[model samples]
Target chain A: MSDKIDNISVGKKANVFFDGKCVSHSVFFPDGSRKTVGVIMPGAALTFNVGAPELMEITAGECQVRIAGEPDFKTYAAGSSFKVAENGSFEIHAKDEVNYICSFGSD
Target chain B: MSDKIDNISVGKKANVFFDGKCVSHSVFFPDGSRKTVGVIMPGAALTFNVGAPELMEITAGECQVRIAGEPDFKTYAAGSSFKVAENGSFEIHAKDEVNYICSFGSD
Candidate 1:
């Protein structure tokens, strides 16, 4: 993310739901933008249902991801990002404690 | 952070102030606890005047830190944590894009 966009004020708290594989915190900005930054533990797989457009970025570590309708899982590493459409679902297999940021947009 | 603490419901948004070296998002919980997760860019140095006791953890990358009255800065890397007393000030030199979590306690 650009330093300009990151310079905004982050609003109230939000949480990410996962059994034990991942932990995330929601960040809202004064411009009404929101994102979540969290960690995904190693050797775990998780599937999530999305309600809006989501952009998932890997900040640290690596993971294999299978977004809905994909034929096979693909590798994503630090500095990589993928997008999921509204109402889509995605699966993730973590290889390490993966640090990530998920940005949501109305789309 | 443990999975249980990681499972927390992250509350409202907060912003961190820095010229261009770092960006952080504030996280609040229902229990009135708070934290901020952020990134410190490479080769940047910053000093902060803290009002409460703060526990800072390096989740990714590396940094050299000098807490108040500390004779020298210590190098810290991933999974390392340090504490700062209330009303104390600290300086940091980032060697990379350092990801961290700063947890604050009343005392």
Candidate 2:
């Protein structure tokens, strides 16, 4: 792949994918795709349930993630890196509106 | 691997790596490593020479990259993603102080 950075723009669509939120945004693999932005509003959370996942740095605000049977939520801030297991389940919550990018593949 | 982002800090060191700048910062692979910050200063450029390279988003300022005898430089701003070939040589230049992160592996 070219070493050039790819620029992507997300317009004014305040998009959020919640538990069971499976919307195809970009075709990452022949049989899989990714989401541009996943938001967790005040008192909101999401449980992801499939695919090989990769997350970009949290660009703004903060959020909490609970993975597997983890007791406490792991907090993350902007400019932080995150990844997800292919068949794992995790919940994400935010005190305010938070936005992030996620990519997935089915290999 | 855990989906949590690994936190790293570069304490008080204004580090820059130029062509032939090979410094091991983090051990990514058993036999390979990565560099945390690569700065290309005003009127300065770098040519990366080895490894499986993955760059984090440009975090500050701006820079230009020339690859494979390409005529013009690819300008990248903060939050842009970039990757590098395992054995390819490319040149980078900046008009001002620019900083970025690069990760590499032996695989």
Candidate 3:
């Protein structure tokens, strides 16, 4: 929920996904920490596979997320964060353009 | 320099900078490409040291940049891109809150 970050480097090359539904860039910190800042355009639902644990925070707009096995989807908006376990998968639905930051953890 | 990037995962932590002058998150692609997307606030100019070559693109607002020994600073607006040599330094001046995506290259 913090609005400030510092002391990191970025990666070269753009990462495109879902036929252009999402786009993001990588960020690296001095202590080896990393995260991705991106925007998701309004459209259909998206399913994502998690390799490592992740913390997804919505910076703008709103969306609903359904974690695997969850009975109901939870809605999130700007300043909200949700966690996804390693090897877990989640489905996201956004009605409007969504800007977010996904932070991967060591697990 | 592209507006849309996809298929990338993000890191787990936020990268903070310059005593709250900037903040960013990391993004990772399935193919290992990485980048950092961030925002720089308006204030005093700041100098940065580069470990690798960097391509800085302004996504919102505008800023002035001085790459190392450049005689004068250059202004960049949204959709504009600039390059910084590996191991080189650069200075940035944002008149207002400036949103940017910086891509790091392996020289």
Instruction: Give the number of the best model, judged by TM-score.
Output: 3
Please give the lDDT score at residue B64 for candidate 3: 92
Ranking by DockQ: 3, 1, 2
lDDT for each residue of candidate 1 in B1-107, tens digit (9 for 90 to 100): 43113323342222424533455555555576767776676788899889989999888789999999999999999889889999999999989767788899864
- Model 1, A1-107: lDDT tens per residue? 43112333332222424533455555545566767776666777999899988999887789999999999999999889999999999999988767777888764
RMSD of 3: 12.2
Off by over 4 Å in 3: A1-4, B1-107
Whole-model alpha-carbon lDDT for candidate 3: 0.73
Write model 3 residue lDDT over B7-91, tens digit each, in one string.
4445544455664456566766556667777777665478889988999888877899999978999999888888899899999
Where model 2 places Cα greater than 4 Å from the true spot, the runs are A1-107, B1-16, B19-35, B69-71
Candidate 3 or 2, higher TM-score:
3
RMSD of 2: 15.3
In angstroms, the error of model 3 at A89 is 0.4
Q: Which TM-score does chain B of candidate 2 obtain?
A: 0.62
TM-score, candidate number 1: 0.50
Interface DockQ of each model: 0.05, 0.01, 0.05
First chain TM-score for all predictions: 0.85, 0.61, 0.90
lDDT of 2 by residue, B14-56 (tens): 1223321211122122233434443344556666664554554
